[model samples]
Target: MICVTLGRGRHRTLLEEWGQAAEAGAELVELRIDCLRSEINLKRLLTDRRTPIVFTVRRGADGGLWRGNEEKRLLLLREAIVTGVEYVDLELDIAKSIPRFGKTKRIVSYHNFRETPADLDTIAEQAREANADVVKIATMAKSVADASRILEAAARSSEKVPTVGIAMGPLGVFTRVLGRKFGAPFTFAGFNPERIFAPGMLQFDELRRDYGYERINAQTEVYAVLGDPIAHSLSPAVHNAAFQKLGINAVYVPLLIPNGKLRDSLDLLSWLDIKGMSVTIPHKEAILPMLRQADGAVDRLKACNTVVIKDKVWTGHNTDYHAAMGVLEEAYGGATSDEVSVLMDKQVLILGAGGVARTIAYGLSRRGAGVAITNRDDERAARVAAEVGCRHISWAARASTPCDILINGTPVGMHPNVDESPVPPAAFRAGMVVFDTIYHPENTMFLKLARERECRTISGVDMFVRQAALQFTLFTGKNAPDDLMRQVVARKLGVTRD
Candidate 1:
């Protein structure tokens, strides 16, 4: 049986939307009092209660919209419990602050602001220590690998009670649809945008129809991407297509977690049923603290793109390194001898200073290429440069140097606003390399301008394919069909082949 959170926070949509959802055979209907603007008469609302009801007055402290301080919020939650609601959700922090309840069992939870926590046992212990009836953890996944870790940890947790594991992001969406497969009792869904508490949540219809329950299961391997602005990701198109082609039961989706909450997201995964996830920008460095063990490459990179929960412990790895290497090798076929050296000689200029840049920088360094990174985020660029041991360039010097391979690592070329390219054409050198990670529109202005100038170029599509293949390997524990994966990516990117 599956329960759907019909409306979020204090939304009045519950009376209509939740009732309709219940009519659709939804096993449970959640009334999120936290979203309501006025007091809810739970006693009056449950007069003809048909299904078991779960009531929550979510606090802003834990991924909710409620604004009341801890004391006031607790007063409301206790009122709901005393009013005879079947289950009441309590933020683990708030619940821990108060003494244990003698009668009501609380659904205690945590939310991540940065990235998913690296350990489930520790997360679950926190929830357990609070004496929560159902421990729920939700983290912001920076990549698909993060989603996998959330699900895998949920499946691995040793708990005396049921737990809800979730990755909150566009990349975490896959985990929402598939959480049940990993022994999770519930997966949150966004029925109305006005009421959505988390980011990149699928509408209830999309969840039941496009990403139906019959597909994902306990044996189904999972993967996803976690990023701040993930709506532009073609990962779903790539991974879902591969799953269909390979006759695999798995699927991919996105999750969005705002800053400072990735750890809470990982706590959700600790309720142990997920597989693994992909980590992304602004989170690779921030995610480091949560890992139990990061050996060899993972420790060396001090960054993680894939998190695996084996035996309830989350061990991190950096498959993005492989993905980055593949992207460089394929896009610049003779990367071994020609292009990289040329790029090194010319001091390749990179735009955007997020996780993608981090991996790409490392990849470029391995090729003996000197690099310069510049972005609007001065601090982020500096940090990324520090990680790659490259020179930090300023946005003011956009055209200061003739870049051999000027790469745009930002979201400037993505769709719905596809015309926007970060660097002006006047900045390009006739024989330079212009690489744009934007693949959906293979000929972004950045790439198109370079084409007109006869400059060498690479599309982010190559990187997407390679990273996805690495993800496929991580999820299925099988060697990926590299050629097949490339073709799939090419088709999705609308690249016409010779």
Candidate 2:
């Protein structure tokens, strides 16, 4: 169940927002009376309301705006309870002072702004001792491990009392969605973006449609795309739609794994019994050494984008190789042999020396194409070129060198940097084909310049969708809905399909 929070400043606005929340399919609404500047008719607010309401007048220390005296705050809560509300939220500090109302469930909540303490069980036990009908444990998550600890605490505490566990922050978003699976009776979501009251809060529509909040169960398999700067990824929208289309009991979330923490994060995945994961950005190459076994594509590219855990062993695979190659083949459409021969003789220039650049270089080299690599860091560029048996072109000489195909393997013109281009506009020629690996901004500056020069262009959307489809197959052992994946990605990127 998704509980929508209403914290508008005016009573009239609050009532209006409540109706909106109800229309949005919210079964419950939380009214933060602390946000009101003046007193409201609590009886009128509850009258003729079909949805259940949870009344809360949070204080300043508890991350609320209530500035009244403790006596007045307690009076307000008591008044709300007498009005026949379904639930009353009280801080754990005042739980002992306030007696439970008849049939009005009491939720003793604890909010920690610092960190998830080492003794969560002890705190939860204290709430249970207070005779709370529901226990809410909310804490600031410093890392993925911190979120995991909170979930573990919830699973343990649920056996005693109904527990609502939440880890607040961007890193804690996974726990917010997966908390229900761990035994949370209901989870909270903002009715809209302007009404969000907590960090890492998602909208109800996103929770319901994109994350499969209502459909997720303890037995549902979990998969995710791991990256540091993951806000720009469309994997969740694309993969979740495919899961719904195929009726797969699975969910794909974005896991923000910071640098040097991959090894530690894998332990959490094992603990949660996550079925599989799709690696991205810096972790693509970093995850190779940690896997028990790897496919030939991963061995050849020296990178892994898909990891499937079977019988507690992790096997890595690289879908980017074939997915990328297939896109290039479609662009150079003709007979299969004719396309290969055309690619083999063409001079292909690739920019950047990261995991993606390495994958493209390896795949192109294996197809007998003459691949030249350049990067801002000469050492890394030389290393990738040497590994791929290709020549490393100096960055200063990229614009002057002529090539039939140019690929922006770097994230120069990705979202939020849409104005920046890796290659200069003057470098583009009339006949060259330009491809950028950044898919967030469908038509990047690099692609725009290529289009102006009458050069053929391919957006990164094709490669992203194709690779994710391949990862889906590896995760579920079912054929993915390719067209649905493409449609979802295009919609997410605000691109018009032909």
Q: By lDDT, who's the top model here?
A: 2
TM-score for model 1? 0.56
- The per-candidate count of clashes, in order, stands at 64, 0
Question: What's model 2's overall lDDT?
Answer: 0.86
RMSD of each: 10.0, 2.6
User: Compared with the true structure, what per-residue lDDT tens digits does model 2 show for residues 1-498?
Assistant: 888878988888889888988887899888998998886577767777758988999898888889779899999889888877899998999988988777889989999877899999999999999989999999999999888889889889988898988988888888878878878888888876776688888778778877888888878888888999785578888889999999998888888889889988877866788888888877988998888999999887778989998888899999898788878867887326444444677789999998788888888888888899999999999998998899999999888889988999998988778899998888899988888888878889999999999999988988888898899898888999999998888776773222
RMSD of 2: 2.6
Candidate 2: pairs in clash: none
Give the local distance difference test score of model 1.
0.69
Q: Write the per-residue lDDT of candidate 1 for residues 1-498, one digit (tens) a residue.
A: 355675443434557777777677766666777676666566656677757877777666565667666677777677767766677776766777655555656777777857897876688778867878878888887865687687666656524667777778666666677667766777666655455667756556556544445466667655556666666455665666667667778766655655666887656544434466677765676777877877466776778877766665776778767766565555455444434432344457889987677767876776677788899988888988987888887887877766667888888977646778897778887777677887767678788878887888878766677777787777767767767767766664562222
TM-score top scorer: 2
Query: Which residue runs of candidate 2 sit more than 4 Å off their true CA positions?
Result: 48-50, 334-342, 495-498
TM per candidate comes to 0.56, 0.94
| Ten residues in sequence with the least summed lDDT for candidate 1 | 337-346
How much is 91 displaced in model 1, in angstroms? Answer: 26
